[model samples]
Target: MRYDVVVIGSGFGGSVAALRLAEKGYSVLVLEAGRRFADHELPRTSWRVRRFLWAPALGCYGIQRITLLRPAGRRGAGGSRAGGTGRGKTRAGQSGGRAGVLVLSGAGVGGGSLVYANTLYEPPADFYADPQWAGITDWRAELAPYYARAKQMLGVVDYPRTTAADKVMRAVADRMGAGDTFRSTPVAVYLGRPGERVADPHFGGAGPDRAGCTHCGSCLTGCRVGAKNSLPKNYLWFAERAGARIRPLTTVVGLRPGPGGAGYLVDVRRTGAWAGGRQTIAADQVVLAAGALGTQRLLHTARATGALPAISARIGALTRTNSEAILGASVPRRAARRRRLDFTDGVAITSSFHPEPGTHVEPVRYGPGSNLMGLLQSALVPGGPCRVRRWLAALAGRPRDTVRLLSVRDWSRRTVVALVMQSVDNSLTTYHRRGRLVAGHGHGRSNPSWIPAGHRVVRLLADEIGGIPGGAVTEPFDVPMTAHILGGAVIGATRADGVVDAYHRVFGCPGLHVLDGAAVPANLGVNPSLTIVALAERAVAHWPVKGAPDRRPPAS
Candidate 1:
């Protein structure tokens, strides 16, 4: 089937494109490689592997996807599939480029929105001043209107009330002598009456009704209460009503110039289906929004096979991790029980603080009964023995405190996760060697795994709450972990410098666009979703309708 456009990966970028084009009377088809889930259909806890993990070969199809991005050196030995999920899986290798980076991204119709804590933030001025694309335009000024419009469209608002986690963050900031920097986080949610259904709150009667946030703290596990402002509830929903077709569980594997000047031919296959179910569809334009990893993987394979000969050699340049690190602290169960502070009482992330210039720290949570932290976090310092042996020995030495911090069932209520990011200038390169996408240190120094300012904030957070400190498992290996992955296939001045132009149109690939994190030229110190949406709004605003001149965007 042919359409005006075919968008791969309905994430922040693709959702914006789908809604805007469909609203403009264009034929749009959004091909999502994951399943479409209704609010009621989402998993209630992260412990349900069959409903929480994204492993197709093991027959466990769910939202959260964890990919082990091995360094380029360890390639040959670990390049084998996990039974049959297609891409060669590498045994988690030692710290290296993207430095021992482990990618935890969302896989579903709404992309990362299916799993992201709804905290929304705009990057600091440093993000705009990066030399890579600073000369392109007055970016901060140029993107201002688009950013405001995106916030409105996303239903962003300040979290209405405070929670135990909020107080802890406030205390942490005070101790840092940065109390002025602490504030309730701005999030995409309906902060109306908890669980009460209300008419369309964002769009004027054009979007779906919503339920107020229940402070269930399950936002990360897919907001079963229907209050979180996920894409399907807004952008994608409006696009569908305006005639956009959403085909889920369909992965695009190949792209080339189409026959009879149809513009482009997109080769696709059913995701997780048996082999040989491929099909081709034509479109006048194709937008790649399959996120940082997904889009880069697809483009690398295409260019290597001569399917996209004009692709720039800089396709993998300047990829970023937002200079992020995940560290945390947990209160002892006895103390938590006495103090009656439930870390899991409010939304996933309710408050944040900046300990020093360019450093941001936010407290994150998961509702009761969700203990996936047991899988992602380890003791802040890895030492004498395995984590199990360490925990067992510690339990024998300090039973109450050890059991309080280590209990799987109570981890959520007793723990506070510190999401740290900085505006430091650093990046990495991605390669599609040996049929797998791997990262290597690029440009400046490798991304920082230890930020003194960030760790100081987490430590203070733990001390204030009277808890034990822990960090990302990969941290001890001199690597960072993050959910906010950006860059690769970035915008540049010319075909020789970058893969795309300032407006997100590929340099040599006509009618091809990349509007996701992959196109961001530099590291954004905050969550990148709002930036991706604003960039898409700016890019698509330049697209002229079929057989007509481009119309001016309405004033905000």
Candidate 2:
């Protein structure tokens, strides 16, 4: 049987497409490569690695997925491979890449929503004014209504309460003379009484019932508290009610034109299986929402293998990770235990402030039961000219701090991990080399490797919060980290510039669309989930209903 539309991943973009298209009376099938979870089935903490991490090769089928990327496509820097386009050579002004850039993503029925902090931020003017696709439309104006729609659908609101973490963040902002910039984060969570289950407050009872947020600070581990508004609870839920079906563990490997223009034949298989579970299915139209990594990987390999040769050469030319850094400020374990300072008393990221121009910072946390991420931190060590001297000096200054961070089992509960993002653009060109993603720094600013402002902010934050300021273990070298990876199959006016058109339609592939983060053309400088949803809302608003051409949500 041929589906009217088959969405390749059930994240923000795919979920919105599934709902809107299904509401239009089209048969929609969402194929997700990860498993689904009932709220009860979701892990309560990161310590349950077998249930929280998604390393299927190791028999773990969970939501969190970590990908380590290196430059020049070199494999063995103890890195997990990032998918790339085809083999290629770089011209002058680019050479051996940075040490490592670790990307964190999610794998589940709801995609990255399963693991993201519930922060929802609208991109600033610079994002809407970006030169890449600025000429196409007045984006801020165009996306305004859709952003409102997205906020409503996702149950977005100003964080209802301030916790200890928020107070610290506010203090930090005030001390830095940026008090006006400090505000409780906009979040997607039910703000009902703790643990109180109520009928759907969104969609006029058409969506799922929700329980109030418990302030468990476990949003990143998966919201077992029924508070965080992951997509499965809203968009996918309504899509299913509208007769859309979802198939989990069904990964699409390739796509080829169907015989006589019937559409496309999508090669399918069980995701992460070492053996055979391959087959093919037919679809009249396809929407690729498998994310920046997954979608670009498929398109690149398809183009390389000649399965989808018309795919543009720019498929993997531009990938952005918000030019982010993961830094930490944690009181020592002994002091933390004495004060009983639980950083996990609020939502994952409750407060944010801009400490410097072009940079956004949000304090993040995890609950007591989850501390695995502590493995990534170490005392801050300045690096640049005096490498050996700096290391020894850092050890002398913060020697006990490193030991405390490493030895603390309740590190997650004691620390706030501040995510710092810069509008200063930097990028990676990801392509397939020797069956793996070969990534190299693309043309852009080089400061992503070392955001001096971000380091200063973290150090100051530590001082204010009564702790030692350190950073991700990879920060000393090439390990910049980001949870918001975006833009590979980006928008362009023609096939020569990008793989997808402004409407998200593939430039050369008819009836094909990329409606996920991968299709985003500009750096958003904030949590990108809301923008992705809003963009998808606009993308499907242009789709024809089953029997007519009249607009559904009315064209933007």
Stretches > 4 Å off in candidate 1: 74-98, 260-262, 382-406, 550-556
**lDDT for model 2:** 0.81
* CA error at residue 402 for candidate 1, angstroms: 7.4
- Could you give candidate 2's per-residue lDDT for residues 1-556 as a string of tens digits? 6898989999999999999999999999999999999888888789899779988889888999989866663442222212222212221222122734788999999999999998999998887766567777898998999999999999899997888888888888888888999988899999889999999887788778889989888999899879889999999998999999999988888888899866888999998888899988899999999988899888888788987788888876668887788888888888888988888998889888988766788999998779888888876765465544665567678767657867658888778788988665556777677666656656543225456666777888788778888777766565577888888798876676677877888877888899999988766668999999999999888888887964432211
lDDT string for model 1 (1-556, tens) is: 9999999989999999999988878899999988889888888898877777898778767888888776665442222111111111111221223345777788898998888998888888977876667778999999999999899988899987889888878988888898998888889988888889988877887788888889989988898888889999888998999899999989898888888645899999988987988999899999999999898988888898888878887887777788788888987767778888778888888888888777788888998888876556655643222544654465477666555555655778888999887676666777788688877766545566666676677777788888887777676556678888888888776776678888788877877889999999776767888999999999888777656875633211
Q: Predicted candidate 2: what Cα RMSD to the true structure?
A: 4.9
Question: Where is model 2 more than 4 Å wrong at Cα?
Answer: 73-99, 383-398, 549-556
lDDT over C-alpha atoms for residue 328 of model 1: 87
Q: After superposition, how far is residue 410 of candidate 1 from its true place, in Å?
A: 1.0
Clashing pairs in 2: 84-431, 84-432, 85-431, 85-432
Cα error, candidate 1, residue 212 (Å) = 1.0
lDDT of 1: 0.80
State, as a TM-score between 0 and 1, how close model 2 is to the true structure: 0.92
Cα displacement (Å) at residue 334, model 1: 4.2
The lDDT for every candidate, in the order shown, is 0.80, 0.81
